[model samples]
Target: MDLSQEEPADWWEVEALYDLCFAPGRTALSSYRLRDDVPPVAQLCLCLWDESDALAGVIRYWPIRVGGQSALLLGPVAVHPTRQGEGLAGLLIRESLKRARAAGWARVMLVGDYPYYRRFGFEKLEGVQMPPPTNPDRVLGLSLTPGAWTGVSGMVTRATPQAAGHKDATDP
Candidate 1:
């Protein structure tokens, strides 16, 4: 599989992949609340293509703040039905996390199953919260730098540069 950073032109294709993989109501999930009007971390947004050049998988990370500290919100990773058992999802997760660490991101969070994300070093984040209706147990985080998650707790909120000066709606 060929992996590359996602380009702007790939938006619709990526969305289609997500639609095919997830339920139609996926956008209404609490995780999508944090992504509203926030741009994804460009370098960390990735796409995977098979030898046939068909898009196989996609993953994205959004900028967010937890207790006013910068971090990333990883989510909506999807693999084509044909590539479901090929480990393409894991590839995207590992590659994107590597890039995120090298990009100087201190931490990353995601709302996902522990059984799947735990293998990537994600652990349940105590005192950290997502939007309503989300299971607190599914709120997980991984530190890229030692002690990065230490003392970080609070609601996850958009951390876009444009919102830097203003208190985030989700901030406590």
Candidate 2:
């Protein structure tokens, strides 16, 4: 598969792929609430295409705050139905995470199943809270920098430039 950073021209295609893979009301989920008015991490938004040149999988990351500290919100990783079990999801995750760490992001979090995300080093975020209607059990996090998640807690909210420890890591 060929992987590339998502470009403006790929917006509709990426959205269509997300629509195809997730529930119709996916945007109603709490994660979307954090994404409102926030642009994703452009350098980390990745698209994977098969040898046939068809889009196979995608992953996106948004900047958010955890207790007012900068954090990455990873989500909406979608692998084409027919391409499931091909390890496309894992590939998308591993590649994007490497880029995220290199960009100076210290922490990453997501609302997802522990069984699925745990393999990627994600664990339950004990004191972190997402917006209402979201199950706290699904809030997970991984530290990109050693001890990055230690002592971080409180409400997850929209990110401000000040929240992003590395301004260049976030979209302007």
Candidate 3:
């Protein structure tokens, strides 16, 4: 299998994979609220291709803020049905996370099941809150640095333009 950074050409195909792997209303989830109109962390968004060159899996991360500190919001990762059980999802996740750490991101969070994500070093975060209707138990985080998540808390929100490495009116 070959891995590559996702390019514009892969958008529709990646979305299709996400659609296939998630429920019809997956976009309605609270996590989507934070991702709306936000470009993903370009280097951390990855695609996996099979020996036949078919798209096999994808993963994405977005910039977010928790208690005003920058954090990565991981989500929307999906693998083609044929790629399931082949650990393609794991590969995408691990690779993306490694890239995230290298890029100086301190922490990452995802809304997912502990049982499955635990293997990836994600654990339920306490004192942190996501938008309503989201189960807190599903809010998990992994620290990319020692003590990265220590004392972090509060509602997760869209990353400020500055925090996302972009400039908007909010920045001086």
Name the 10 consecutive residues with the lowest summed lDDT in model 2: 163-172
TM-score of each predicted structure versus truth: 0.92, 0.94, 0.93
Off by over 4 Å in 1: 161-172
What lDDT tens digits, residue by residue, belong to model 1 across residues 54-162?
Answer: 9999998888888888778998899999889888899999999998888778889999999999999999999998878989999999999998999999988777646
Provide the lDDT at 148 for model 1. 94
Error of 3 at 120 (Å): 1.2
Tell me the TM-score of model 3.
0.93
| Model 3 regions lying over 4 Å from their true place | 161-172
Candidate 3: minimum summed lDDT over ten consecutive residues — where?
163-172
Please give, for residues 1-172, the per-residue lDDT of candidate 3 as tens digits. 9999999889999998899999899999989988877777878889998889888999988888899888889878888887799888888899888888877788999999899899999999998999888999999999999989999999998875555657211121
Report the lDDT of model 1 for residue 13. Answer: 94
